[model samples]
Target chain A: MPNQHLIEARGVTKVYQTKDGAVESLKPLDFSIREGEFISVVGPSGCGKSTLLKMVAGLLPVTAGTLELAGKPISGPQRDVGIVFQSSVLLAWRTVLDNILLQAEIRRMPKAEALAKARQLMSMAGLAGFEGKYPWQLSGGMQQRASICRALLHNPSVLLMDEPFGALDAMTRETMNLELQRIWSESKKTVLLITHSIPEAIFLSDRVMVMSERPGSIAAIYDIDLLRPRTLDMMGSPAFAVFAKKVRAHFYSQGTLDH
Target chain B: MLRRLLLLPALRPFLLIILLLVLWDLAIRIFKIPAYLIPRPEQVVQQLFAEWPRLLTESWKTTQATLGGFALTILIGIPLAMVIAYSKLVESYVYPLLVFSQSIPKVAIAPLFVVWFGFGIFPKIISAFLLGFFPVVVSTVMGFKSVEPDMIDLARSMGASRLQTFFKFSLPQALPAIFSGLKVSITLAVVGAVVGEFVGSNSGIGYVLQVANGNFDLPLMFAALVVLSTIGVLLFVAIDLIERLMIPWHASQRQVF
Candidate 1:
């Protein structure tokens, strides 16, 4: 029997109308995310990686072709999908718990249940003492952790992350990777992360989808045979190097390696 | 240390006022300037105490008009900003008129308001509303426009309804900016009320200043001026306190010691 696909994209494309005329953002592309799978898309800046993710999240309209989540055609924002943007984007006026609870409040979830889930996600994200603190008080990495917890608060099946750790320093990025992997393992939610860093993409994803510059289309997809519970050690190993090389070769072919 | 820290901001301004008063007293004594030319700070204080009953009543009248106009500005300006911020069509229609109104000096319209509404507080309140309304509208429109696009996308992605997106994200995000407008407009509200009184009112601190000016009673003029400034300061502080309560999470509200 065929494996269950949670997210399906069939010849999806995006075109933006501008003062300079029509701009093709994403070329016709097809892909599917299996149930509880972790997928990452790596590409250069301005290569429509973000546009593709936004389309999938139903935040942006797909200009052409078909995209579906579960069995339904995605015409607008869906209830069972959550998104994490490049920045933490936590509201400065709200405490961490309040920011996380934003998702619950939007969905109109029961207050008692939402509060319980918020506390659980906070502790899981290692943000126990910081719940009542404002977002500005948390460091870059901690803020992003709280953002992830916020995305997961509603228990959505699909979590779409767009360069979630791109703002952090290298050392913080690595720690956040481990934290994310731990969260993913525990939650078993389908995640599609968009990133610029090759190693960051390979370290977190089950399969890495590489795309070309401008009018971005999938150039290649590599399935990682690396073991579960991936760590910093795995990034230094020979096997990880091989996967990184493959993802890099696509950027080289497109001559976008400089980006 | 804590007490010093708490009191220093208040203390510095108070000390400066005292030093200025001392300087003024010395200048008057050393130069032997006539009281009619410039009343010493003590004479102004004495005048304020001697005419306390009349001064208090006039100050109260100005205060009522200022507050009434400010309350009206909040009611009208915010909704006007909402309409302008949300719809480009409405903005194009309304924004030019707003700019045009500003071009005509609000003080020039104060007497017209008196002619239309008679010598009542209605003209004073209207003048205050006119002066206060523009800053509120402009600042609020700017605040509404400044909401980060990513924040809007985040709200939309969460399956938030249009109203939910506004209440949860847009309104809260615009709050600090809105408070900034309120702070500016509250001070202007006092000026508006005073301008109306200057033009034609028989009561209010502004009218007191006018009578003192005609009589060349410098001490009384100084006292009325002090009362006007006091009202401006108190209104500004009230709005500031409200801002602190409303948006303590804002970076501006974070106290550093």
Candidate 2:
């Protein structure tokens, strides 16, 4: 059978040695994400969900196991992958448009073409009117959206988002979640989101991977069979509640499993 | 109404200076102070115009030395900061020595600089560099070392090379701190040049001040002092303008509410 996955991780483990002692952040893990799939990795605080994301993004070294992106061994960060974090991380000095154009500039792409694409992405992210404004001048949600636009400006094959909307307020977060779903459907890039929100994971992800505490490993993977074009109404459905309950149960069990 | 409101803030300082001048003139006239003891503002202005050519030449010399030394400081200081910031071993070994050297006042070393480099612009420039170098290096190091970790990670994850990270992120982020250091260094640069001139130079404002003192030319001395103060203010304003032009994103550049 042909491997339809865009990214594959097998027997992955991460060990961190501090001044006090050695700590294993992530246990040996095996997972794979299919092309154009939105997968959210949900786990307790201190779990290695972030560590796993970092390794896949090529921001951290894998102590063991293999990670393949587009059937190529993960060596270092590639321009083909875009990553976003909780913080907007937009360059304060650069205007919104310029910040989005940074990736293109770094890649040495043609300025006119890059800018045209950036303008499209900005409009798609609802940031067209604030193109000249600095990051500090924009509201939190707007800044986060600009950052997302920046990540997508290069047309990366994979989007790795580590709690990108975690810092926003409730209303903004919900709005952003809808915006993100829209963006994802529109872009059709494979996404691996590391989030702590169960409802968010269930609402946005095709598969929610619940992780165990320290020396973290996947406790279980819950598949959401909900139909496409999911909306806030789907979040209130009984089916959504069932899916969320299943993931929450796995998290509860993992807390006991750690003992 | 708008124009008047715009002028109000600046007018306060201008009015304060005028009040100070009026008070000084009145005190001199009422107390019948001798010109040798305290030259009146009018006398100083008259003397300034009379000795304008000499005063202008000396001012030019001092300005040249200050600027030359400041340029040299930037050339040396930024690289030193980069090296120290990039290497922990170098920082640990060199940082203490730098602190110890700075503790030795440049004024005390002025004569030694003159002895070594003679009564040329070199000694004065060296004095200015000594005065200006520490702030530049300290600020540059702080700027380079204090980059946000997330920003670095974001750049790294984009496959940016080490040099690209430094140029794109580190350098820009450090600009505000570097400008702060430059502002302090530029002001001190003038004082350093003047001190070096006072020690041994045959020309420059400090030399003119010494000549006026010997002849008891109080008006001339006050004129030199005014010129010196003006040079310091102009140099500082130049640095501020550059800072505004270069790093307009800095919080310092923002207007208060």
Candidate 3:
């Protein structure tokens, strides 16, 4: 049988050892992300949402508790997971296609297979004609799209994005939300997105995970009832507002001003 | 159409030079400066033609010494910068020593090189390297260090080995800064070669200038100066061209053409 849980976390916590003292960055957290599920973690800035994503990606370690992907503990950088940071972080030196092909280069994927896969991903991400352009030559949204293409090039089972569209403008962010839904469905990859925007969390994710202030722990997990192929108009519907309101209320309850 | 051609960016520098030469020729005629002091621009041109063979041979020597030193500097500087960029412990040990080396005037240290290595082209190359390598090391280290932590995180996320990360990501990221450092050092390398020749060389433009000084050959001295400046400018252009080739993607290189 296919694994029910692609990623499972049990009482995961992070405490950074600073010169001042041990600062708790994340509370003991228990969660599991199902295979092919789209999940968005919504919380205030510095609420350790990024810390959680980093742990999932195996870029950072948990101080306590177990974090697993495909039943293997996440100890270091994983070959099976891809991560996109808030910034696109495209290498200015490499062209769009070469930047995406970095995945193949690092993973030692075959050249022909990797190139074909990259070409398809580029078209899916609406970056079809920008294969040769450098990062600086592209717009903010296009650059982020190229980075997203890079993350997906390896065909990882899970894509961990830490506010991938956070740097984009409102209009571009809306357009990207639609593009992401299409890509996620077409790619059939489980996604764990971290974002502060309530609408973004609700619009993109199958479930929106709300977190409390630093020493961040799960405040609530709301299942998004919206239909598949979620359109921008659906985001304007009452159902979307209700989810947005619920996620927003968690922040107000904590008296944390950060969004 | 001619006015537009003169205003063309590539041609502008030459136009300013020609205009300056005319003003210089006028000043010499109006002031009636003696030939021993400031020769007329035409007199310097005449001397340039007269001494072309000798000047070409000496210039070739200086060019070899300067280039040999510069090549050595780049060879040593970039790898040293890489070592220091990645390790703070090594940096603390090496950075201060580099500063101390730079603190000693290279001109003052010229005689010591002659004493140690004798008055061969080797001493001149050594002098050029000593003077030129420091900026290259400093700027390249700064370049490597300036890379975004996010870029590195991205690399590591993909399972990029540390060596792969540096060569593919960090090295190219640092190229612009490295090239700027090289441009500055190339000019200094020329000066260092001249200093080496000053300390006891019987060849190069420096030796030619010294000989011209003794004989009161002002035009020859002017010719030598022109050759030195020409060498410096040409080397700078060469580095700039290399930078353009190496990093056409870089924003700085975009508008430069």
Best by lDDT: 1
Can you tell me the CAPRI class of model 3?
high
True contacts kept of each: 0.97, 0.71, 0.95
Tens-digit lDDT string for candidate 1 (B89-188): 9999999999998899988778899889999998999999999989999999999999999999999988788999999899988888888999999899
Residue B129 C-alpha lDDT in model 2: 88
List candidate 3 segments past 4 Å from native: A1-3, A256-259, B255-257
Ranking by lDDT: 1, 3, 2
Candidate 1 wrong stretches, greater than 4 Å: A254-259, B1-7
What DockQ results do all the predictions give, each relative to the true complex? 0.85, 0.65, 0.81
Candidate 3 residue B98 C-alpha distance from true site, Å: 1.6
Model 3 earns a TM-score of 0.95
Instruction: Identify the runs in model 2 with alpha carbons over 4 angstroms from their true place.
Output: A1-3, A249-259, B1-11, B27-37, B254-257
Assess chain B of each prediction and give its TM-score: 0.94, 0.93, 0.96
Residues A1-259, model 1: lDDT tens digits? 1259988999999999999999999999999999899999999898999998888888889998899999888988878888898899999988999999999988889999999999999999999999889899999999999999999999999999999999899999999999999999999999999999999999999999999889899998999879988879999999999999888888787465752
Q: Per-residue alpha-carbon lDDT of model 3 for B42-160, expressed as tens digits?
A: 88899999999999999999999999999999899989999999999999999999998899998998989999998889999999999899999999999999999888889889898
